[model samples]
Target chain A: MIAMPDQPSRKPLVELRNLSKHFGEGQARVDALRDVTLTICSREVVGLLGPSGSGKSTLLNAIGCILEPDQGWMRLDGEVVYENRWLRGNLRRLRLEKIGFIFQTHNLLPFLNCTDNVAVVLHLAGWKKSAAIARAHELLADLPVDHRKVAMPGQLSGGEAQRVAIARALANRPRIILADEPTAALDSVRAGIVMDLLHKLAVEQDAAIIAVTHDEKILGRLDRIYRMVDGALSS
Target chain B: MNLAFRDIRHKLGRFVLTSLGLSMLLGVVVTMAGIYRGQTADALALLQATRADVWIVEAGSHGPFAEASRIPGDTREIVARMDGVSEAGSLTLQTVQLVQGDRRLRLQIIGYEPGRPGGPATLIAGREITSNRYEIIVDRQTGLLPGEALKLGRRTFTVVGLTSGIVTLSGDSVVYLTLADAQQVQFDLAPPAARREQARGAARGSTDLVNAVVARVSANIPASLIAAEISRWKHLSALTAAEQETLLTRTVIERASRQIGLFMTVLTLVSAVIIALIVYTLTLDKTRDIATLKMIGAPDRTIIGLIVQQALLMGVSGFIIGTAFVYAFRGVFPRRIEMLPADIAGLFVVVVLVCLAASALGVRVAVKVDPARALAG
Candidate 1:
């Protein structure tokens, strides 16, 4: 068991200790993570750097509360959410209220336009439709993508869709944002622009952001960077 | 709700095309159900038009349709003398081919007394059969109008009046005539053969036997009790109005009813499977989007709701279009397609249930999607 992090006067916004994840069983079991520990304070943009097959994505999933780890303690804003193989009651509600996620594929719902895509999370989190749409418009205007707010996923360019996805992630004003390779599909210019937006949103909104990326160009903009190798994080 | 409506609008062409296909399937299903209901209604209409309380036929035989039933014509007088019996009439039923112009039309001839209980209730055109001979009342669906001439055996009869919706169990049109005329047509053999047979049998009689006896009872009398008393007599089977209807449906059209029921069940099952496939395919196309939604903290219930709403929309749209199409084309159907309100309501309930059940496949697939896959490179 890993020692519990000391609870200071103001605790970290997100924490993971001794996290491990293994896929399959017995002979086929492959350990994807091994005793990983990490943290991100509010208003910080932390970058997770690694080569392919590293545990960066595995760590991100554990933080997102999507994959239950084999052994770990996970906390969001000083709350002990997971220990080893179990989660606290109402993890779904917790996810809805506390977490947002962005993926490499710009996985916007094709059926919904940019604005509705962004507003969906707030709607799911029990916001009224008008309020959710208003918030979505505000976020899009902030990102300066409001001109294409009515465009569908198929109608938007790669960078525009990714920005819409980011707007969707911020819809519920979550405490933590988990972005897995958010810039992987864009060109260098577009990638830098998206990373800048992520950094600006993190600092301006006082939200914690952990973006896992293989793109080294955006690494310099991160507040801190951690590299992962062979299922473990390294300084 | 916003997402659901927006998604449907965004994919309007695909949704409408799929709905059209579903509507066609529903149309066939509704038509099948209507046909079955029509069979039941037709059976009831035959009984209702008779205006009789009791039916008497040969013992151990289902009369009017199932088998040949011949009882002495004097049996009507015997039943009229029974307790609670007010009036009785003899009726004969036979299938014959009538020639009109160059066409040969098959008809079920019904013979009844002119002023008795077994006559037609109303005529839609022309006058009722005033002359005892050489005049016939034809079902309007038979395509014969007033003053049309039809040749039956060596006799030419003029169509006096036309009645509606009086087809036989076999779907053949019906022709109603006086007892004397119907007896001649029903017992008419080749003239030489009839003479030779009569000579050989050595039986010449003025009395004409009928296939069955129809009796009207006093409204105060219990028909069941009268039927029971008549059944007590040897060599005769008696049925009340309700029993006669049951016998017609159970014994007369039982095979056709079973066939129609099986067809309806098969169509319903086919409809369910088609809906399931369409929903499953639609969900499969959106697997990645669903995973992303799941990863973004959309609950399982939300995803399930989205899929189910789509299925229900498809079902409702299909049902509305199908109902409209059935009603619009009902008259053009060769056989009657009776669309009753109860049947429509029942089909609506079934369609909703089928939609819910069909959506289960999509819901299962959506729930099983891995949120990790949304992040995978």
Candidate 2:
């Protein structure tokens, strides 16, 4: 499929058509993603729900430009970023400028304090340290663990650590945030709080969020949900 | 925002301990180098101070340090008569262990004629051997002051003058006496041995033997030519000053120098391997963090910088601490130890290169880390 420019207001923040990924060839071939397509608009929080061995993560990774799809037409913020091949010359730079990721374990660098955990992303994107740290403080200010901003990762409670990770994911004001089981390790109450924070940041920053999880309890917190079963997707 | 420093700060104690261990290893290499250099200087010290242009010794001998070389005392008179020879002196050398107070001190006794080419060029204390028979000029390491009395070979000799920084290749202090006194000290036999010789009807061997006949050739005259003429004499071997220096350094201390060099190489190799293993282990420890860093789109330089900087920190700190350790205890070592700034700097360069090479194992592992692993459960 050829990528066509979408008109401004109707254009999706992230768009994919006919994306597929295969792990191996011949008799042992395993399809990780099968002709899957997805679209997420600004200010929308979407969830990919699936059990273990399902292709939810494969789709998320493809949308994040981490692993290119075998075949796809993809676009980000009105730019045709992939056409069966990555059009971006530097994939790392593209990821830094356009995407944010939150892992299940709140993978904050153990060496950095809470603020530096967030500030490092901005600094990597060429922001000056003073401004980057100031921005980190601003992102952390609204979180419940804002008072613990100077604490190391090991010193943080599970809730506090997740909050710091959220601040880091939103540090660069990325157009898209991909969270893989963002609340998997938190208790129900903290999970609710984390979902609320993601929703609030999505609308406030006008950024799209794609969360992959099997936690049906938080389905109500999402605007819409897509389900995956054995490498195929259904709405 | 320095990642390497931040990681190090988090594990500050472990990092410092690792560097300390590396420093101890490096200190051995440095100390060995110092000993080698000091030994070389000590081996050449008296040879350099003698100011002799030519040396005549027993035929086919490498003496006075490497092997026992002896020639007749009157051989100097024959060398003095040669053309281009300006001055000559008979010299004798022997090593003796003497009981000084409660301890035995090993000394290199050198006997040279006064006002000749073989005597010390300068004195650091009092005057030179004023009276020939029982006066001695000793190196400062002996702890003998001017006018101090010391006993050697059944005679109590008075120390009339002192010299500094004079030692034998084996790091023994050297003392100077008149040629006749040295021969007596060296060749004198105990009363029992004299009786045995008399009972056997054996005549006493000549006590007029000298270790070498030293001479100076006139300016613009080649000392080697004078040495060649002296070499033609029966039972006499001659060497120029340059040849003597070579014989002293290359022949006298070659084995020990080579052994120390081997030790330096082994210690350096051990240091590199330790650093490599340490850096590799550190990299393995932070595999998850590295994955996240790459996942977050940090440039490859940032990752490389982290490992390389840590390696360099270890190497530089090791060298600094090692050099400091050697210098701090140089006087305590039995053998003389010396450190030169240029030599230290050169060692530091080698250290840096070794560290970079050592870091390669860590860098390879870090760069190959899959950023996609960060997304995996």
Candidate 3:
């Protein structure tokens, strides 16, 4: 696959240039990410397709600031957030305030209900509990799982849990949404539903989303899809 | 914010069961502390009941307890003549065993001059001794009633009074008697023993010698000053009332208290370890959840707070339940179990500290958890 030829007219919402990350040393050394370069424009839904150990997850983690890249120039909303080896500010607070993450397992807090799980980030971002919960209910109402708003994660079905995770990601209205195989555990219908929801959220919220997945069923609906192999990426 | 509570609620049965187990351990700790205090109280009961300001014993003796102290029975007269001394009386202490019907009873026999310091201070039944020769005051624990005949030495004596909460450091019931009667019981020997003692060329000791002389000082004078004056005598050692009390507690009950104290300390430590193990197990069970929390941008404080808060709740609840359990069953114990408000408060503080220390185990595990694991398939 060749890299997408058409460059967006607007500044990319997220950009990673020549990022490199490695594990081990000497003969045992293995590059997990090899000078990976990519950009996601606002409202863009970028799909990362890879098998296990292909480094797509690594790229998502680096962008999410879960792990600092050994070398990279990364930007979010055209602001330099990571350059070389230094971060712009506190990575955790950056992630809390500006990045939203969805996981393959829909890692909703088991003890919390759907509304509470979604409201936690809002509360962390300084919203009052009542207001945050209200916002969470509103987001759930917009999603397909509004009826399960008060249900605990353990009680929700797989698709319903994924819906709650999406609502939680959008709680803070973050600029970047990172999803790692968000629909890998769902049936095709449920996977299509999650993909449609992600696309709808991207267009409506103008938030860039990068989802890593092996499910090619939703690839045609994505704005662009990148295939990763042996720590390298191609479109 | 209250995720810890939510998790606890989710596992309410397990949490409650663990708390109950922890509470039982805490109950033992509390009971041990109470026993230690109760032993101290029992040790000092006789001293406090005497209401004397100073004690005059034989020179180089810790009195009645650590070493034998045989001062002249007439030492009371000498102590009374000292300036600032308001009154003085001879006192004797000895342990005696007696057979009453089929039961064998051991008691601490206290000898005091009638109408003087060293008499039974509180009587719950009957009158104080009227006869200087054959009447005795018995603690209620001895199962003796007024008018009951108690045999000691070669003579049978009638119980004239009953007292409570008086015991020796070894936890024997205390019996009170006239100084002369106690002396006869203490020093008098059987006919055959007397003959043997005479053949051995051992002098028959005077029956008037008492263990110590207890004295009260006038309100204007300090007992320590009079004691200092008495200490100058070549053959006499004088201790202020406080010193005597300290001697009794430190020497008579010191080992017992230390044993109970050690037991309490170990129980507390065991409680902490048990809590740590439980918290660590709970954390291990929720490792993935914790990692997910971290991946969702929860700070280290939030994650640690979840664990520490749960541990603290368990500890505080366990302490309350344990303290309640101790209070409920304290009387069932054979020995006195004294739970003072101050002691209870102190134990609560110790429990809280132990709980926090225990939470450290879980906090370490939680903080070291890799948030990136949440991203793994």
User: Which CAPRI category fits model 2?
Assistant: medium
How well does candidate 1 score on lDDT at residue B186?
66
Q: Which stretches of model 2 miss by more than 4 angstroms?
A: A1-10, A24-29, A142-146, B77-86, B98-102, B121-127, B142-150, B159-161, B189-199, B217-222, B225-229, B232-235
Candidate number with greatest DockQ: 2
TM-score of each: 0.90, 0.90, 0.89
What are the chain A TM-scores of the candidates, in order?
A: 0.92, 0.94, 0.94
> How do the candidates rank by TM-score, highest first?
2, 1, 3
Evaluated on CA atoms against the true complex, candidate 2 attains a DockQ of 0.64
What lDDT does model 2 reach?
A: 0.87
| Docking verdict class for candidate 3 | medium
| lDDT by residue for model 2 (B32-59), tens | 8899989988988988889889988899
Identify the runs in model 3 with alpha carbons over 4 angstroms from their true place: A1-11, B77-84, B98-104, B143-150, B153-160, B187-206, B228-233, B250-272, B340-343
The model with the greater lDDT, 1 or 3, is 3
Question: What is the C-alpha lDDT profile of model 2 across A1-235, one tens digit per residue?
Answer: 1122333453379998888899988998889998888788987788999888788888888888888889879998778889989998877887788889999988999999999999999989999999998999988898866799899999998889988998898998988999999988888888888988888887777789899987867888888899998889899
Candidate 2, true inter-chain contacts retained: 0.56
Q: Each prediction's interface RMSD? A: 1.4, 0.8, 1.2
